[model samples]
Target: MTNTALTALREPAFPDAVITEAIRWTEQNGPLDDAQALRLAASRTADAHEGITQRALLLGERIGLQPELARARQWAPWVLLGLAALIVIAGLGLAGNVVGGGERHINVIVALASLLGLHALTLLMWLLGLLLPLGSVNTASLGWIWLSLTARVAGGKRGQAPVLVRAATGLLSRAKLLPWAFGLVSHGIWSLSFTVVLAAMLFALAFRSYTLSWETTILDPEFFVRAVQALGWAPAKLGFPVPDAATVMAATPATPGAAGQRTWALWLTGCIAVYGLLPRLLLVLLSAAVLRSRRKALQPEWQEPYYRKLAARFTALAPASIVDADPGRLRGAMPASLPASQLHDTLFVIGFELPPDMPWPPAGLPAEFAAHAQRIDGSAPARRALLDQLAQARPRTVMVVCHAVSSPDRGTERFLREVLMHCGECRLWLAGAPDAGATQRWLDWLRDTGLERITASDRPDIAP
Candidate 1:
C-alpha cells in the first residue's frame, strides 16, 4: 500500500513519515540518546523545515512502537465487522416483525413506520448536527465507537496504540475530516442495514400471502387514502405501482386480488428504497468522495511552535562539514553593546559547537531556563538568526555552553563577542570537565578576546 494510505489505515493520527520523524526528534531532544539523529541529519533534505517530514519508518519498529500499532490494526477490522453483522441481523429482524411472517394481516402504515421510523429520526439528527461546528456531527457514530474499542482492546491503559489513535483523532478533528471520515462508516452501516431490510421484505413477500391494509379508529378513510397516495407518489414516478382510488377505498383486513397485492408490494418496497436505503447510500458515497478528495490535506501541522523548534534543532544537529563556512570567510562589523537596562528578565542558554557526546541543557540547570535553551551548529545562518532574535529581546543573561575538551578558535571568539553585545550579562559554561591547564587556556582566551568579565565554569548551577 502507498505510505499515506497505510498511515491512514494504521495510525490515523499521523502519516508514517511524520510519525518516524517525530520519534527521531523526540529521541534527540528528549533525555533519550539517539546517535541516529546526527547520522539521519546528514542525509536529510537541504530545506530544514521540509526535511523534518521525510521518512524514517524503521525507527518505530526499532523502538517497539510497531508491535503496539500492529495489535491495533489486527483488532479494528474484526470489531467493525462484528458491529456490521449485528446491524444486518437487526435489520432482518425488523423486516420480519413488520411482515408478520404471513401469519397475520399486515398493516401497511405500521410496517412502514416499523421499518423506517428510527432510521428517519437518526438521519434527521445527523443532518441537524451538521449545522454545528465541524467534527460535531455524529460524535457517537459506530465508527468512533469502533475506534475507541479498538484502541482499548489493543492498547488498554498503557501502550503506544491508544496514544497514536488519540493523536490521529485530534489531527483529523483539527483538519475538519472527523465528521466525514466517521460519517462514511456510520452511513455505510445504516445503508447496509436498510439494504438487508429491503431484500428480506422482497423475499418474504415473494413466497408468502399477507393482506395489506390500513386501520385507524379516529381518522377517516380519505386520510388513509391520501397518506398512501402521497407517500407513493415518488415511487410511482420511478415505475413502481401505486393503487388507484378504488383499490385504496376497497382495502380491508382480507387478501385482495393478485394484481392489487402486486401493486401494494411494489409500492411498499419502492417507498423503502426511495426513502430509507437511497438517502443513506447517497450519503455513504458523498462521505467517501469527500474523504478521498481531502486526504492529501491530512498532514501534521509542521508550522506550530513545537515543530518549528524541532526543525531548528534538526538543522543545528547537522554536521559542521555540511553547514559551516571557513573561518576566514566570516564577515560582519562588530555590533555596539546595548545598555543593561534594556535587557528583559530572561535566561537565554545556547550550546555553541558542543560535541555530540555532551548531554544538552547541562543536567543541573533550573527548569525555568528550559524554554530559552537551544543548541546551534555555529553556522552562519544559525548565527544570524540568533543574533537577530537577541537584538530584539536583549535577554538579561546569556550563557554560551561549549565543549571544554575542544580548543577555542577565532570564529568562536568573534561569535561570542557579537552575542555579548546583545545581552546585559554573559557567562561561559564549559560543559565537560577538562584538565586545569585546558580550563585555564579557555579562561585566558576569553580575556584576550576583550571579555574579562565572562568567567568559564564547568557546572550549570551558576546564577543567571
Candidate 2:
C-alpha cells in the first residue's frame, strides 16, 4: 500500500489498524527517543505551522482503514433517521385511529401488545444471540449492513455523490473501513430511529385520548384483568399508573365512561420509554464507551510483517530527512478514468495493489516486463517489503502500472516519489485505457516531479 493509500481508508471511530494506535501513542508520549528518531526521520519534524525552531518528532504514518467512506457514513444516520421517523409517525397515527363502528374504540390490548411485544421480541433475539453466540442473530451486524446499503443506494450516483458518499465508497471498496465504521453507524442509526418512535408516541398520546378495551370470545374477563395487572407491575413501579381490574375488564360500549384511560396510555408510553428506548440509548452509550476503551492500548500489530517493517523504515530515517507534512492537506487526488488492460512489453512493470478484476502479472507478458514487473500486495509493511525486494532487483528503468481510472491521487503521487527515491529513473505507465483527464494528470504529476519523461501511451494488450 502506498503511504497515500494508507490515509485513503480512514474511519476514525474504531480502533482497527496498528499504525493508528502508534500515532495515538506518539501524540500522547511526545516525540520518539533520539535513538529511534535517527532511524525514523519521517516520524519527526518541526511543526511546519509552529515554525522551524521546533523540536523534531518521530510519528509513524498511520493509514485510515476507511478513509474515503468516513464522510459518506456520517450522512447515513440522519437519512435513516428521517425515514424511520416518517414510519413511526405514520404508524402511530394509524395505531391511534380506530376505523368503523358506532362506538369508537381501539383494541388497547392490540396496540399495547404490538408496541411492547415488538420490543420484547427484539430484546429476546438479542438475548438469544448473546447467550448462544449465534452469528446470524447478530442484529447489530445486520443493522450496519442495512445502514451501509441505505447510504449507498439513497446516497446518489458515485460520480455525483456527496463527498461523504465518496469517502464511504472508497473505504468500503477496500474493506478496510468496515470493522470500525459499520458498527458505529448502525448502532447510532438504530438508536436514533427508536428515539424518534418514542417522541412520536409521546406527542400522539399527549393531546389525544383513545378508549382502550380487550375482547375475546374464548377468554374470560378475569383473564385480561389479571394480565393487565401483571403486565403493568413493572411499569407502575416506574411511575406510570396501571388501570384497576374494573377498568381492565370494562367493555367501553357497556361501561361508557373515560375512567382509567389516561393511566393506561401513560403506562403504555412509559413501557416503551423504559423497556424500548432506554435500553437502546444505553446500548449506544455502551458501544461508544467500548470504542473509546479499545484505544487504550493503541499499538501496531507486531505479528504483521508490514507494521514491523514500517516501524523499522521510519526509525531508519535521519532527523534531517524529516519533512514537515500535514496529513489533512496532503490528500493526493486524481479522478478515476477508463480501464486499462494487461501490461507487458514495458521495461519494467511494478503494480501497486490494483483492484481484483485486473489480474496481476498479465498473462503471457513479454519476458523483460514480466521479469521486473512486481505485483505488490498486502499492508503498508508488505508493500514496503516489496519495495525492498524491488530495490534489490535494481531494474534501471521501471514503469509502475496503476489503475488509471483510479486516478493519480496524493497516495499515487507519494508512491511514485518513494519508488523513484529508491529504484531510480522510474516512470508511471497508465495501464488500461484511462480517459484523457486521468492520463493527463498522471503525466502532469510526473512532469511536476521532474521526471520530464511525460507521455500518454494507450497500447492495450501489451501482452505481445
Q: What are the RMSD figures for all models against the true structure? A: 10.9, 18.4
Encode model 1's per-residue lDDT on 1-464: one tens digit a residue: 01221233333435563354446444544534434743474376655554554423445656666676678777867777777789899889988798855565677888899889988887776666555663445566766777777778887787666556655676666667777767677777888899888888888888888788777789898988888899999988889888887777777664354247777778889999999988988987777666777776677665443444444455445444311234444343443455656668887889999877777867876676678999888886787588767766778888888888887886677667667766777788777766777778787766555566776788776764
Task: Give the RMSD in angstroms, all C-alphas superposed, for model 2.
Answer: 18.4
Candidate 2 residues 1-464, lDDT tens each?
Answer: 11111222233432233223334343343534444433334444432211111112122222222332343446545555564565466545544443222344657677666665655675566556545645455534534455445546554455213333333333342333333333344345445555666676666666655566667878878888887778778878788888897677664556657587777777667766677666766665554454454433332333232233333344223233322233433323332211122122235677765778887775535566675566765355665566565444444556677777765554555455555534334555566754777777666655554444423344423322
TM-score of each: 0.63, 0.46
- Taken over the whole model, the C-alpha lDDT of each candidate is 0.69, 0.49
Residue 436's C-alpha lDDT in candidate 2?
A: 78
Residue 299 displacement in candidate 1 (angstroms): 0.4
Top-scoring candidate (TM-score)? 1
